[model samples]
Target: MAEHRRLFFALWPDEALRQQIAAISATADWPRGARRVPAAHLHLTLVFLGDVPAERVDAVRSVAASLRVAPFELSLAGCGHFPRAEVGWLGCVDAPPALFALNTGLRQRLRTQGFALRGESFRPHVTLARGLREPPVLPDYPPLHWPVSEYVLVESRRGRAPAYTVIGAWSLAPVSD
Candidate 1:
């Protein structure tokens, strides 16, 4: 059997933003048995690549390298829950178009590279907590403005504590007017 690594592409936030997100999460009324996502693990996933064979890592990197998206401000303004997934999340009220462009471009390119992606429609969100029995009504908060400048390839290690390590990153280009 080939060795596979669990990986995904995501927007890793800086320390300040990470702390802010954590603080907001701390204030939420999570349901019993809810597991709050750790501060260090807070990220907005662009595409979940799942498990990829070790040899195919280079192909994934090449796909990311070819993407050129402009930096955009993302306003995380609301909270919601995915009942089926049993997770609560933070989402943008009005997502910037650049975000969609980048996601679509990456998915298309990855498919062309022979990677099979999930068929679900893109719903960009930051998972705040998991393992909820029923969705909680999250407290309303002011919009958290996030300046997205880069995307990264992350490796997820599951064990005593789930951890994510960023193996590669690509900077977004200037906004085209």
Candidate 2:
């Protein structure tokens, strides 16, 4: 039997922003067979819990459900590459402290629940292209800001292209309320 692996949790980008990012990626001369993530799938990943067994999904969800951080506005600015020329991604110029705190708390909670920590330090980014060689110089796009109120746990499948399936989502109540 193929093992069912649980994926990561992230805040999805809005439709307009997704379209804008897609447009930027489309103009880049990506290498052959390099797949661009679909606009609908653009998101800021919070935690990547790779390869959890199907039976453990509920436990992960319970941990996520206990997260207490309130909704906050995240602004996306600037473009950058990852692992050198191999990958390209979009990033927030200024990540609010709340974002960092939330990530740290989630990491701790998931660790207590027995999830493995990603080896690299959390440099939060939304990936645009995989297998990129020479990234194109992009014009400055206007900064994008959005209120993030929820996070979703997604399942990924590798095929001709990488695809994500939402396994569960948890909402964060507004702090002001």
Candidate 3:
């Protein structure tokens, strides 16, 4: 039997944009127990598939590669904590329609291929930090602009500090000027 891989779909920013987004973490005072996510690990998850068997990886890859979306812009702004989940996240003030369609397309294909995702609602956010003891007052900040061109399938390997590796990426159609 093939080993299962913890997998998810994410919108990863280019290094420069990633740095811009990561800087937002420094501006806030998190609640006790908060652990800020490292700069390299910052990404907005499109859909999280907890685990998939080794044999099914190709099927997942095919589904990802088949998706069709035009490139769109993403605006990350504002930071807040989910009091219950203790996750402090940064998110877009205006999530574009293309983002929603891309998400739905991936979910539909995955479901047909026998992968069931855990969550019912899809809220677009990049988790900045976690383990918040209490929700702090959120702050308003200028939007961090990131152009969404492609999304990747990431594998999370367990270790002292879990490592996330991009296994595959699919590009969206480029918009004509």
Looking at model 3, report the run of 10 residues with the lowest lDDT sum.
133-142
Model 2 misplacement above 4 A: 29-34, 175-177
Determine which window of 10 residues in candidate 2 has minimal summed lDDT: 131-140
| Model 3 pairs whose backbones collide | none
Q: Alpha carbon lDDT of residue 76, candidate 2? A: 76
In candidate 3, which residue ranges exceed 4 Å CA deviation?
137-140, 174-177
lDDT of candidate 1 at residue 94, scale 0 to 100: 89
TM-score, cand. 2 vs. native: 0.88
The superposed Cα distance between candidate 1 and the true structure at residue 85, in angstroms, equals 0.7
lDDT of 3 by residue, 1-177 (tens): 668999999999899988876666777777777888899899999999888998899999999988888999988887777778789888787899999988999999999999988877888989888888676545566888888989999998887797999999999995456
TM-score for all models, in order of appearance: 0.95, 0.88, 0.93
lDDT string for model 2 (119-165, tens) is 55777777887776756455677877777777788998877777888
Return the clash pairs for model 2, or none. Answer: none
Error of 3 at 95 (Å): 0.6
Q: After superposition, how far is residue 117 of candidate 3 from its true place, in Å?
A: 1.2
Per-residue accuracy of model 1 over 21-40 as CA lDDT, tens digit each: 89899998999999999999
